[model samples]
Each structure stands twice: as structure tokens, then as C-alpha cells.
Target: MAFASGSRADRPNIVLVVADDQGWGDVGYQGHPVLKTPHLDEAARSGLRFERFYAQAPVCSPTRATLLTGRHPNRMGVFTWGYPIRPQEITLAKLLREAGYATGHFGKWHLGSVYRASPVHPGRMGFERWVSSPNFFDNNPIFSDEGTAVPFQGESSVVTVQVALEWIRKQAEAGRPFFAMICFGSPHAPHQAAEEDRALYLDQPPALREFYGEITGIDRAFGMLRQALAELGIRENTILWYTSDNGALPKVGSTGGFRGNKGQIYEGGLLVPTFLEWPAKIRTPRVTRVRCCSADIFPTILEIVGIEPPANLPLDGISLVPVIEGKWERRPVPLGFWHYPAPGISTPSAKWMAELLAAQQKGEDLPPDGPSQRAGQLPDPPYPSDQFPGHAAWIEGDWKLHRIETAKGKIRWELYNLEEDPAESTDRAAEEPERLGAMQKRLEAWLRSVVQSLNGADYAGLGESPSLPESKSR
Candidate 1:
């Protein structure tokens, strides 16, 4: 793979903005009757809007891992929320930094410990600077500033944007291409919106009022970010991509009529609202129905910036350069999603940071061998390659095949033609036995490849990681 243009000057500034727990129907352009997202609506009208964008997994940490690595989370053992990204994997931030891009990460960094010594902290993961939280945070949150706990005032979303803008502005002044990952910690559980934002949604139930308000706050912060970009004169060449980490919350979130919610292997849990704006490249507004996933973001960005990925690393995502250029009508490969049966590590950002802040203030240092610091430790290898347990889905074009393993170890298969039934209300497995059989075989093969990777296949001798088969999808 040759570099896209061969000049660093040709690379555009990239900003990946992710929302926590936001759903497909949460934005105004997506037909949300209540949420007022004027800025997002405008971006959709003026840029490339994706009708079928998916998160690699139905949870936050896994999806975030895919966005950063372009590889399936399972390949690195990030099976659920709060799991740290394996240190052996190369991240987009690390690659971009190596390519002379100023990289910064702001807001939630649930992939690993935020402490300075943690092997998987943003600083060690290639972020030149970061003000990050270990998990979802609330207003007046305390964040880890390169391992030092610092309390920030005002709304969490506002604080995140402000911190990121400060760094972005400096990069603009220095005339350097920058990649900023702004992950907002709002609209998640225990939604706590700013007072003024909450007032706009008083008509809704109390809980929903806060949830809607949090979304509104995100909208305001996003508007501020866009305005800042224009003021800096970098808006035209900046590729501003926006999407959520996962599906909606169970009660207070909307799935846009899709079946299932967060943490499930259904349309509602996977599908997300996504769009990109880069006036220098995307001069005309376009809407693409072609299916895409968060994993594609890594390769697409690498292609756009003319950076070559590491040769030995296998990517579950393919570059979407053709789609962005309006030359692609369909995806070239199937998308695989698996929810391995593993309990999530509890990583409460506010509580942990508060404790750190208190400890620092008291002149006490916490031990380095704490659970947070040891998050990246690998489990014993030799995982069962024969038995693939959990809910897994394989999507090719409009057809989706689900391979589910019941607690009793029975395997059940269901097929859905998503184009005809986006809700997944009807099963087509019995009616289309041949198609089901073929998809099942492919899905199972992919699952085995994932298992192989989990058993240290992909790593070769990098660590104790397993190897993946050569025929595995990249």
C-alpha cells in the first residue's frame, strides 16, 4: 500500500468525536422529535451521512477499541466495557503521532487505567496530551491529567471540548496536522445535565428530562467545537467525523424503532448515527446507504493521511476511501460482531478519580499494583478453539446471520434480511435454508479465527497471544 499522496502537507486534520450511550434516533436529523441538534442536522445536510453505520460491538470499550485499532476487540481481548486495550496492538493515535501528527485524547478513556504508570494509559498509548476519565463522568468531574487528578468545573461535555480546543488551537497556530479523539461522557447512566439544558426538556419525565438535556449539552459543545474550527481557519481541511460509542440506554434512550438496545447483538444495539465533514474533499452533500462500521475509521484515516499500517497486524476493517469519494455502492467485505460472555470490569471514573485526588492531597501514593494498573495483564492462554460461546453476528450486504449459544450450550441460528426488515422482527432462516447454511459456515469460521486470535494466534511471538488463520477476514 503506497501512501495516498506522499506528502504530509496533503493530510487533513482529523477529529473523531464520539458520544456515550447515544442512539440512532438521538439526533435531530435522524427524526428525533424532541432533541434539538441544529448543528448536527446542518452537518448531515452539508456532508456525508451514513444510513447504516455500525459500532463494532454493542458496548462502549469494545467499540472504542475498534475505532482506535481497526481490529476486532476480541482479537485484543477487549470483549466488554472497561477492558483495557492490549499494549501489543498499534493504535491510530500511535500511528498518526509517528507520522508527525499532533495527537491528543480528551474525555472518557475507558480502555485502560488513566494513572501515569499504567501501561495502557492514553499517554503510553500514543496521546501526546490527555485529560481523560476512566469511565463515564458527571458535571464538575475530576479527570486524570497525565496521571495527576485535576478537578475541572462546569458541565462535563463543555469541559471536554474546552480542553481539546486549547490543544487544537495550539496545533493550528503551529501549522501542524492534528488528530484529536474527543469522547464525551454524557447521556450515559445517571444522566446529569446542566441546569439550563435541563430546563429545555421539562415537559418530559424527570429522568428523561435529564437524559434529553445531556444530549442538548452535547449539541451545544459540538457547536462550540465547529465554531472554533472555523475561527481557526482550519474547518475546510479538517475531517470532522461524529458517531456514538454504542446503542441507546435501555429506558431513557431511543433506538429509532430498531429492535434490541445496548449490550445486545441486534440492529438497535449496533446501528449508530454517523457523518463526516471535510469541505476540501466532500464538496457536495451526500447520503450513503452502504453499511459501514467504526472499525473502518482507522483504515480510512490511515488512507486519507497517507500512512501505511504495520504489515503484520491484521485489521478487521477496510478503508472506506471509495465510499467517502462517492465511488462505492456496496461494502467489499462482511462485518463481524461478537459479544463474548465475559463480565465487565467496573471502572467508575468519578469515584476513582476522587479517591486519587484525595490521596494526592493527603500526600499518600497509591500502590502501582492496584486493579486499575494491572488491567492489561493477559489471561492464561490455550483458550478453547473448538467452543465459541456467546452471541455473534455476521453481516454481508443486507443479510445478517446470528449464531447464538444458549446457557445450556445449544447453538441456535437466525437470519434476517436487514434491508427488508431493519427491526429484525422476522426470521428468514427456515425459509432460506441454503443462505442460512452458507452464512452459518462463514460466521463459524470467523468465530474460530477470533478464538485463535484470543488464544495468542495473531501475536505470533509478540506476547503470549494466539495466532489467527490466514483465511481470516481482515
Candidate 2:
């Protein structure tokens, strides 16, 4: 099904489909027993499948920040989930629109809802027409369509795709070249799926069955998305990307035998499923073993769409357009990982998270809030730059280092040669002190650079929440 021939000069439409909480092996090609991802499977067979792509962070907002800016999330001040994208950043839709493309984003937009009474919504973020939710939602959800929160019925996954389909059809009829981002929130938390979707995998255990059912529900809609594109004659030229926000939620599906699940700096936590389909440009069906991260996406898309990147802006990710075009050149830049010094609760921590969720389900509810959703500039941190310390990591070549700081002590260190051991099973700090020492110095240097970036050394404090035409936050 791969497109036999074509070129970027043809100005193909683009569709970036992102799945929330989907694991590494939660599909047919990855060898999951219950999950059935026919559309994604066929897309993989029809295009380039990246076997070792990673999210920019182990959590959501940070990785998404990377997606929009082509820079490390931490560098842009998105150190955790639900953080704002620093309104000053450059986005793909905005850049692509410079080329006469009609840009839109439909589905989950966990970036920032309303900040500083500003109109920095999707349209301000470079998207022309946006029907988005602040974050993940269940069936019969209420979401913001451009500004108004509207109610929609159906399973969350199906509803997510259905909304995007409607938008795509409109764009097609207008003969506009489009770039759409479809964010699906499924198999995350309080698992919900339609009875028919659940029945599709009723043979499995309760948890596994529910997990698989949610995935299958999304899979069917993904197939429909492809079909709709083909019927519109846009499938062949579109560079359709399919990937997850992060890794699995554990037990639901394997993180492909990597160390940790989601919400950790470990390979398993950050690694995710990634594939690119373009019937026009991609010739042979292929698989990439090279490591790629979410930050690289921005630069790659800009290059593909012929936008000249700012030379003054330092980007941690190189353009991946060459790699996607069957070229063989590895990215030479450093890949950064910062889990922040703050200890936030992430999922799959035994029954602790489950218990919190269960209690809320029982109606003893705790209101959810985060910094990004809070209106205005808000307050800055009380601690100095040095006080924060959960964990920080840096990956250069095949070497990886993890730094752990105690409440009142010098930070401890651990190192691993990922080339020799990808799973990071053994800490070679004690065994090979010199290699460890060298990596520690490099990691520190990278950290200093990160600190500089965070302080706005790059853009000089230019990006901030724009004043919205109307305050959506009440």
C-alpha cells in the first residue's frame, strides 16, 4: 500500500495522529495478543516505522512542548505534566501556514487552556480551526470548539477521531492544503469503552480486556481516518504520523521489555511507538533503528514544508527529514532528559494511583488543577535554581547518566553504556570509574546549557501568554 513515487514539491497534506497512554506493544505489529491495530499496522507496512523513537519526556506536557517547539521541553520551562508551552514558542502549524497551508488541530490540546486572559488558543498557536479539549476525557465529553465548550457523544477514542474527520472533510471541500493533529485519549485511567468494543476482547482478563478494548476502539477509527483520506484523494500525498504521547501504563501492555513504564526517565518510560506514512515521497517500506525524539519532529516538519529555521535559536534536535527519506545519518546533538526535582505522582505505582482514582470514582472527589490551566502569570518558584532535585538525565551517543540528589547531600550518580546494554540493567559507575566520570562532566555541561536556555538566553524572554480577545477562564 506504500505510495510508489512522488516529491515534497507536490505539497502534500499532513496528518499527525497522536495516541494518549498507548504502550509500546499495544498493536498487532508489536506482538500484543489482544490489541488489534489494523490501520496502524497497514500504515507501518506502507511507510517507515521507527522501532526506537522516544517522547521528549516521560510525561505528557513536556513531550508535547517539545513537539511544538523543536527544542527540549525543559529548556522551554515545561518540566512536568500540565505545564504551559511558554506562549512565545514557535509551532509547526504557524510555520506551515506561511506556505499557504490551512492549518488546524483537533483533539486533545493539553498545552494551556487560558493564560493571562489571552487569546493564545489554537488559532494563536498557528492553527486556523481547532476543536480541542484541555486534556483527556471520557464518553459524552464537553470540549472547546475554537472557544465555546460543546458537548459530543460517543466513546472517547471514536469521538476524538470523528471530530477530526468532520474537520478534514470541510478542508477537503475547500481545496485547502491542510495539517491536522489528532490527539486521542484512550486506555488512560478510569478505563472506558463501549460494550461492543469491550466485547471484541472479552476473552481476556478484566483489566487486560478493558485495555485492549480501548485500544481496538481507537484502531477502528484510525482505519476510518485513512479511508476518508483515500476517498478524498489526499491519502497518497499526506505525511501521516502515528505515535503515542509516552509509554504504556503497565500490565495493560508491555513497554517492550524496557526498564520502566511511563513517568520515569528510564528507556521504557520515554520510548514510544512512531511511524510515518507518505504514499507520494516514501518509496520502499522501511524500518528505522536510529533513535529519534519528539523534539526532532518540529524541525523535520519545518524542513519538509520549506520553512527556514531561525539560526539564532539553539535547537536540541536536528532535522529528521533526511532520516525519514531513507538517508542514513544519525543525529549528533545531545538528547536531554530532566524529570525535575519535584516529586509528582505518576501512574502504575502499585494500587496507590488506582486507589486515588477509585476514591474519586466513588464521588469523594478532589478537584483537579495545574499551573497551565491557572489564569495569569501566576507566582514564580520560592526555591533558588540549585534547590530543585528529583532526577536529571543526559544521553550522548550510547552513554546515559542518572543523577539523584538527597535532601541534604551531594548528588549520587549512575552511568550505563546504552550501546552495550540498552536496558540499563547494570550501573557501571563503580566498575568503570573513568567512563562514568567523563560522562558526568558531559552531563553537567549539558545541564548548564539547559539552565541557560530556561533563563531565556536563547530568545531573551520573548514568549509569554498573549492576551485573549475574550477570557475563557471564569
Q: Best candidate, lDDT-wise?
A: 1
lDDT per residue as tens, model 1, 94-172: 8888787888999999998887678788877778888899998999999988788999999889999999999899989
The window of 10 residues in a row where model 1 has the poorest summed lDDT is 465-474
Error of 1 at 389 (Å): 1.1
Candidate 2 — which residues are off by over 4 angstroms?
A: 1-9, 114-120, 343-370, 373-388, 461-474
Give me the runs in candidate 1 sitting further than 4 Å from their true place.
1-3, 368-372, 461-474
The number of the candidate with the highest TM-score is 1
- Candidate 2 has an lDDT of 0.72
Range of the 10 consecutive residues with the lowest summed lDDT in candidate 2: 465-474
Q: Evaluate model 1: give its TM-score.
A: 0.95
Residue 471 in model 2: shift from native, Å?
Answer: 17
